[model samples]
Target: MSVSEQFVGGDGVISTPIATGVGTGEKAEVIGHRTADAKPSGEYASILADTPLQADEAGVASRGMYSPLTSLCNEPRFATMRRGHKVMVGQNGWLERPGSIAKKPEQPKKAGFFDSLKRIAKEVADATEMKSSRRVKGGERGRASSRVRISLDPREQSLLYCELEFLLTSALDCYINSQFNAGRLDADKYKKVVDAWHQKGRPKVVGFRYDLETQLDLVFLHMKDFRFYGDRASVPAAISGILEAMRVNARALRVRTFCQPDSVMAKQLLDSQSLLNLLGSAEQRQIQLAEVVQFFKIVLEREHKLQRTEEVRGLPQ
Candidate 1:
């Protein structure tokens, strides 16, 4: 006889492309189901399709659970493509209604999107270790085989932006100044935040979602670079909202963000100088400076109210 026995059986104990090896054939391929119970399980199996291939009832159910066709889009408050823009909230259902047309603009719809994404991002902290897969757990690489998986979803970015907003409101000012990284968003702020994250501030999760971190860093960078809306008055509302969100952290926080008289035609329409030529109203930039100060006052008042509440909780009176 030879060093080993090799055979391939299709319907009967016949032959196929995999016949035999060379001299050192230390294995045997019993073409037929050598098991005592050779009856086929009712589960279907096809090489070309993802038909269930099972030898028992338990395996059949397991196949259905782990099938690639399983839907992960049944949750609510996740991202969905509505019209031309992405919608954020859909009742308790998170499934996408693809090909739906939008009648409005994305900017106007951003608030609702932001709210939904934030909720889901917070949900990421709860995902745990996934169960072992059949292929990696049964075949050559047994149960100890590690499974690595990565997915990039748009909702993660949206949720990250939510956290970034929250961080700006809650932690960035104190932390950034403490780390001495109060320039136009540099490594120092991230270093401080990451340290806090590892210590006690971060959420627990299943896997390291790199996209979330990347998106947060980009949002911070944009916030740091913002400077008076580049002297454009038409977009004053936009700049004002962002500025209200940002608080001065460092007494020595020195960053250059300048806006001159003649930057944009749209801005010129709102500038005091242009108004002087038109109606000779409040000159000497009083009108612009006054409005800016009023906006900041409102932000400061809201912040003070929050602090007052905090103080009251600590008092015995």
Candidate 2:
């Protein structure tokens, strides 16, 4: 027969029964009642050593009769030792069991070499197209600027036309005189004819000081008309025709006899021809007629040194 002892377990509500007087190598049967459950239950029993039991500061007895394996399972470290469980150090050195940390999002894929090359090519093409467009616009602006129009009043135009007609007639008369009277080129007669030609349709003045400005005005007035009418090309053609006519007349009169190198008449004729050639060349080169006239005035002042008493004999006259 065996004697049964009843005592409260570590938890205050559960009562455990321990049987004594069991034979050696035989296990004692212990029955336990769990207050958490609705029924009294018993598990497979193991023989435990008779260890002394003590109470902690909380007035609860220490579990001395429990198996070492059971005590280890109840430890804080091994409590969360199952699969996929995590343990971390919480605030104040406490152990914490939290859920899994979220994974970082994957990085985006890199661009390929061919894609980079294509992007560079497109950028270059765009830059070139922009440059070409700008160049075309600049060219158009240059063309527009080049076609500048000049304006003139009717009175000025008439004066310019009359001057040109006078110059043409004087050139023809000089050429005719050179042809007809090759042996006797009368300088006085030539001067008289030119003075008479200029006096036509104007008030007769006994003596007037015709300065450089007056001479340039009288000679270059026709240039203004040509520029105003946008007929600059005709200037060269007119000069060429006059030069051709003079050459023909010179040929008929025998060049050596008509243009004596040492004579004042020959020098005047040559100077007139040179002045016309210079004007034609200047026109072809797009030089401003005002600048040409200024230069011509300077040359005339330096060479002729015309005084207040002398009349201004214009280039062709």
Candidate 3:
């Protein structure tokens, strides 16, 4: 018989039976398993194709093998879901919160030399502007104050001079009387009393012009002695009065200097006014009073001849 006719007879099989260990004639089907259907078309086809459940076409895949790979593509059931956000492997594991990653801290920016210079310059400019504005306001206030007239009439000036002279003589007399009553100045209190007396005397002598330089020198020495020993806390109101008197003297001297252009008295009064202002400023209060007064006296006693002029004559001139 021909080979095709022999193989094709009745049932479709080889003429001779093929050898088999598990089955003879036909292969056995496994329970609960079947050949997977050929992949579906359209969207279903694409999904199955993309899923890892589908093996490469070159390999044979079993129907029972779908559980592991297909699990990856499934939406997890709420009942079996885990409680944290999914993270990629090898990403930072530290968390700022239970569900979020910690962010990296940014570095502080460093300033350059030029940047520091710019900041300093801006600060200096702001301070200078502020100071200038303050100075302008002060000048305006000074001008406004100046408009209130201070009469320098001869009668008024003479009365002021006489009152100051009386105050000085009265203070000296009071101190002498206290000394007499205390039965000779106590040894420990002697220096204090003497200093008080000198302190009392300085303001009185400051406004006057001396006929001889010796008199001015003696008064300057007395001022130094008083400042050295005078108690600041117990500083009498008379000291404050003296300071005010010095201020008045400065203002009056300025006015007189302007009105009488050819007067030595005005020049002398100006020098005395400058010294008083130096000693009376708020800053001078903190310094060693003796040293401050000494410096003031030295400046005042500098050798300079007074011009001979009859205009703006002082008391007893």
Candidate 4:
């Protein structure tokens, strides 16, 4: 049975891969579609091919919702390959025109390829329960049978990135909420920051579709002006607040990563099993919290140094 059929509890159901919207200069061709009714309960399935798939009335109307093969690309927002550069889908529209601004030259377009494969492998693992696939003998055993590789299309990759962005935003909100609940952050500050985030901060990040380090920079920028209490003693409280925030966030992220459906962030977290599993034990949680604090400290100090250097350069050089 194909992995997808396993998802919907279907077996021995031969699914023909269908193509849709072929040779349409404005649209993308897609592959891998099982029959509409072939998919069992509470799941959506569609296939895209070089040519459009002829589906029943209900399927025909819904086909455009998921696939880039026809209507998805009809919206200018869907990421498309242009001059070999992949575009990013924006929350409301296209983040960038493919060649408008060159992205970091060194960064690769298909960076999430392996991550998608790993996510599918993890999905298979969870579906079959890897423990059952294991053969514990003498000293060594065979690898688990619950492993598979998947090559994601550019459209799929864009969707995964969008989902991951949403998850990160959710995690950040949880962290902020934890601090607010602990009384470490002022109510006014919390409201203002969150409002600004939803109104401006998040939209900006989503627009850029930043990398991890750039995202961290954005976080620091947002938090730099944050004020809880204007007192020297409050400095320590501020740090502690953020430390607690990160601790809570890390644990929440761990739970979310394991329980949520397969995605890019989940795959990244699973790859770093130590970090993902840290919250399972008290000692590990403590260790992870300390590392998070140290990392925050390093970033803060680096930013301070850069500011100082810039000031000095502005004055003399």
Enumerate residue pairs that collide in model 1.
Answer: 75-94, 83-101, 83-102, 233-267
lDDT per residue as tens, model 2, 109-197: 97664344334334433433332232223356655532221111243223322332233333333322222122122223323433543
- Clash counts for the predictions, in order: 4, 0, 0, 9
Query: What are the root-mean-square deviations of the candidates from the true structure over C-alphas?
Result: 29.7, 63.1, 53.7, 28.1
Identify the superior model by lDDT, candidate 2 or candidate 4. Answer: 4
Q: Write the per-residue lDDT of candidate 3 for residues 46-156, one digit (tens) a residue.
A: 001111221111112222122221232233421223488755443653433555555778988987633543343344334333322322234455454432222233433
Write one digit per residue (lDDT tens) for candidate 1, span 1-317.
Answer: 11011123233222112213533323233432222323322211111111221222232234322211112222322223245554465533345456654465556544453244333322221221221121362355543433322121233323322332332222222222222211222333333444445577444221112123332343344443422212333465544443332322111112212221111211212222222221112222222223222222232234334445766797421
Ranking by TM-score: 4, 3, 2, 1
Badly placed stretches (over 4 Å) of model 3 are: 1-148, 183-317
Model 3 vs truth, CA RMSD: 53.7
Whose lDDT is greatest here?
A: 4
Give lDDT per model, in order.
Answer: 0.28, 0.30, 0.28, 0.33
Q: Per-residue alpha-carbon lDDT of model 4 for 146-215, expressed as tens digits?
A: 2222223444434434444343443333333222223233323323333445564343222123333233
TM-score of each: 0.16, 0.18, 0.19, 0.22
**In candidate 1, residue 227 scores what lDDT?**
25
Error of 3 at 158 (Å): 0.8
lDDT of 4 at 40: 29
